[model samples]
Target chain A: MGKRVGIEVSIAIADAVKLARADVIAAYPITPQTHIVEHLSEIVANGELDAEFITVESEHAAMSCCCGSSAAGARTYTATSSQGLALMSEILYHPGPMRLPIVMTVANRALAAPISIWNDHQDIMAQRDIGWIQTFAENGQEAVDLTLHAFRVAEDRKVSLPMIVNIDGFTLSHVIEPIVIPDQEEVDAYLPAFKPRVRLDVKKPVTMGPVGIPEVYTEAKMAHNEAIKASKRVILQGWKEFAEIFGREYNPVETYRSEDAEVLLVTMGSISETAMSAVDAMRDKGASVGLVRIRLWRPFPGPEFRKAAGKASVLAVIDRCLPPGAVCGPVGAELRSLFYKMPGAPKIFSFVAGLGGRDVTVERFEEIVDKARAYAKKRPTELYEVIGVREI
Target chain B: MAQIDAIVGWKDLPFGCHVYEPGSTAKFRTGDWRSQRPVLDKEKCIKCGMCWVFCPDMCYSQTEEGYFEANMEYCKGCGICAHECPKDAITMVPEED
Candidate 1:
């Protein structure tokens, strides 16, 4: 195990990318996510990392450059936040179907309208169905670990799908933490050189992103859909291998003292750490409460999630994003539909919290559990409740 | 005549539906979608190559006699060549008649 050193999460993520030895870094700096690519650029300038860091004009251009370099058989890396991710949304859908295994870090932040730059799931949830493999980091170490894991799984020949590692903006990105920086030899053994399954070449050329006419459009989308769904296997295998090489092990759904709990608190991103502390507090008070932290977001980890939250009588689910005019937040709706008609299913109480970087403190978690328990007995008329919003 | 008539199902598509063969467009004849064909009048032809330079599909090429001829296989008959001809050397006519 390498020595754990104190470093900002963004810098740690950049070092992780360097350890992976990315061939190209194309990105437009955005708030919160800026430090990640900023460090990357400096590394390239100092000859510490032999990579081309293309400073693109806009997020759209950044993603466009990523597509081009990745298609030309280069291991690509980039980072973006809320609006930056929103801008890259258009071209973001390309890399997955094209099978260019580009790894990106998203400093999760709230979207604009009210113009707040803080940590939230709103940014990532907005682009939720972009067809890239997405995973959440509960803290700085997970942020660093997931960055390396993203590269490994994404570049797997059978699972050549782009991946996004979502780290909470100020919570994880800006915070300083003691993280074990793996040795260069260790990372090299863990993640080998990228070998593109199909790449653009002059001598023997292949036309990528050709016009998909009505004849083949449906079939083309189906193939991409199947490939991404199949990538779940490789995603799990990646963490397993990482544990063998490194000491830490990661899972799709992580549990905390929920073995015999009656109520479970569900959360994602960095706040999951807070939820764990709250679970410990609840257990001290003789409350049958546990916590479930979902690490894998895209493939949804249906089987593992069901196994973790199945025994609970109530699930106090927290979502940082509030999708306006919708029945419930994204995570809420997913669970509702997942357990919709199952026999003896747990009553799920969806609560949207921590919007615009408001802290989901341990106290707030206890409140969510109390509400979930109350609502379990008498269901609330509202589809989901947005907690911590002050009302007159 | 080279249009791809037989489209494969989902299971049979090449990975990402990528075309492995270079210049695979050569096998596709888009002319079938055209309603009109370009008629070149050699009598008025000055070989200025305006038609060759203006064709959207690059269908016009200079023949051995220094006259531009349209390769009917790929032309969609958009009439940019006929419209841009300096000497009125090219005109579009209904393909049916």
Candidate 2:
């Protein structure tokens, strides 16, 4: 393993992009996510990384510039948080259908109405169906590793899809952790220089993102769908190679001590670490408890997730983001769909917790496991419950 | 107007629907939408090329006699050519004429 050093997660991600040798980075400043671009701008200014740093006006322009740069055969990158991501969402859909392999680091934050600058999955959840290959990082190490993994899978000739690495804002982004920054030669050995299959060259003069008429729109969309689905093979392949190179492993649906557990805690992002500790505590007390964290969000690892959670009788699914007036939280809803009508399927108990930088402590996770076990015997009144919401 | 020749299955479609063929735009003959056509009078034309320059769709092309004529295949009957004619040499005639 490489020498580990204590560094801020956001800064570590910036360093990861630098190691990827991205050709272009265009971004706007937003909270939690600002540190990443700030560090990157300095890297560009200091000439440590030979890359174009475009200080764009808005997140919209940041993404549009990414599309343009990627189309022109530049290895493009960008980063943003909640409102910034919401603003750039229209252009966000373009890169997917346009097949631009631009990588972005999203510092997941709560969306505003009452206004908040804190950590949550709501920001990324809003863009769930945008057709980008999305991944959630459980810690700073995963954040750094996933950033590099994103560039590799996204730029792969078979994939060529945009990717978003989601790190919970403030919770994961602001914290300083001991991270092993990979060597330049190691990164080079793992990820080769970008070879764009198609590019905007005057000699070629090919049209890109052209107006797809009704006759061709469905076909075009179908092709994009197939391409994204096929990308999973390459995604896994990249991760396998990454594990071989770095001696660190990653999976779509990662499990911890879930072999014979009756109750499983399902979580994503930084909260998974806390959930793990909770599971350990429960196991010490002789309770059957385990943890399953979702690493890949888009092109969701259905088979892997099903296999991991199949043995458990009850699932205490935790969602950091709550979509109002839904049957359950997004992750809850997805899990329901996964196990729906399956024989001997686990009973899912959805819990909404840790919204807008709220702490999802070990005690809260223990409570979820107990509640999931209690509720599995009988259906709860409400489909999903919001934990720690004091009605005052 | 003919639709894009995209009747093939999803697998046959290009990645991201990127049109790699050169001059692919030439396939869409937009002139079918033209309700009125530009009728040019060779006698009054001074060969000033105003119609060609003023054409929004690049529909006007100069003939061997130096008279600018609207290519009906791509012309959208915008009437800019007739309106911009310095000598009033062009008239917007309905397609029936």
Candidate 3:
């Protein structure tokens, strides 16, 4: 094992950008996410990383610049969070459909009503259907590792879906931890420079984003769907390759103490750490429980998730945001579709928790599990349960 | 009016407005002209008037709630209404040639 060193998550991301040898970077400043671009800017300015770092007026333009650069066959990167991400939501779907492998770092932050700048999954969760490969890192080290691997996974010919690597705002982005800075020679050997077979080459004119008629419109969407489905194999392959080089492990879905447990708790992002401690406490008290963390949200690992939650009597899904008038958060809705036909698939209990950066303590996780256990005993009434709210 | 002998040389038409030789490249291929007409879901439409306003050839009639029936006589099946419908109530599917 390598000796551990303390480093902030922002610097870790900058170091990953350097290792990835990103050809072009364009970003706008936003809280929590700002430090990452700032560090990258300094690196570019100091001539440490030879890349075109363009500062744009807004997040939408930032993404637009990425689209142009990636289309020109460059390894592109960017960072944003919260309102910045929401602002760029439209263009986010365009790059993937065009099959440009642009990697981005989103410092996960809470959405606004009054306004907030704290850590939450609401921003990235809202972008679930944007056709991007999404991953959540629990800490700074994972953030750097995943960000580097995202480029490799995305540019793979089998899976040309763009990827978003998410680290919690302030929590992971500003925090420090030991990150193994991979040697440039090693990274160059691991992640070869992007050489697109198809690009916007003026020598050979080809159409892109053309208005397709009925004869071809559905075909375009179907192609994108199939490409994403194909990405599953690419993700596993990328993980295997990354492990071979770095000796670090990664999976689409991660389980902690999940074996021989009747009850399982599901969550994502930074809250998994909290959930783990809660599961440990519950186990110490002789409770039959475990935790399953969903690392990849998009290209949702339905089959893998089913295998992970095998034979559990009750599956409690915890989400950080509400879908308002819907049965549960988006994650719960996606999970429910996976087991609609299976017999004895276990009763799924959806719980909404940790909105607007609220503290999700160990006691709260246990309370959610207890409520879910009670509900599973009765006839299923509703598909969702709102946790940690005072009902009048 | 003077002497209606024969309407020849009109076969060089492009949009069926004229006539031309069968094998000529300038002649229209009727096979390519057939395409799907746009269908509107009136129930989900919110009187946005976007479809009517955005029709490139003004083929859509403005109804009180939304655009009225598409005029197939002039409708080229361009699908501008389908693309511009913000509510996604308009759909275009293939029609028999």
Q: What is the C-alpha lDDT of each candidate?
A: 0.91, 0.91, 0.82
By descending TM-score, how would the candidates be arranged? Answer: 1, 2, 3
TM-score of 3: 0.80
lDDT tens digits by residue: candidate 2, A217-305: 88888888888888999999999999999999989999999999999999998899988888899999999999899999889889999
What's each prediction's TM-score? 0.90, 0.89, 0.80
Best by TM-score: 1
* Model 2 chain B lowest lDDT segment of ten: B1-10
> What 10-residue stretch in candidate 1 chain A is worst by lDDT?
A210-219
Superposed model 2: Cα runs more than 4 Å off? B5-7, B29-97
How does residue B29 of candidate 1 score in lDDT? 68
The residue-level lDDT of candidate 3 at A54 comes to: 97
For model 3 chain A, the run of ten residues with the poorest summed lDDT: A208-217
* Candidate 3 C-alpha lDDT tens digits along A1-392: 33356889898888889889999999999998999999999999999999999999999999999988987888999999999999999899888768888999999888987599987788987888888898989888789889988999988876766899989888889887777777777687779889875677777655555443443445566667777887989888888998998889999999999998889999988889989999999999999899999988878898889889978888899888787788688878877888887898878889888877788899999998888889888856777877778787
TM-score-better candidate, 1 vs 3: 1
Candidate 1 clashes between residue pairs 3 or more apart in a chain or in different chains:
none
TM-score of chain A of 1: 0.99
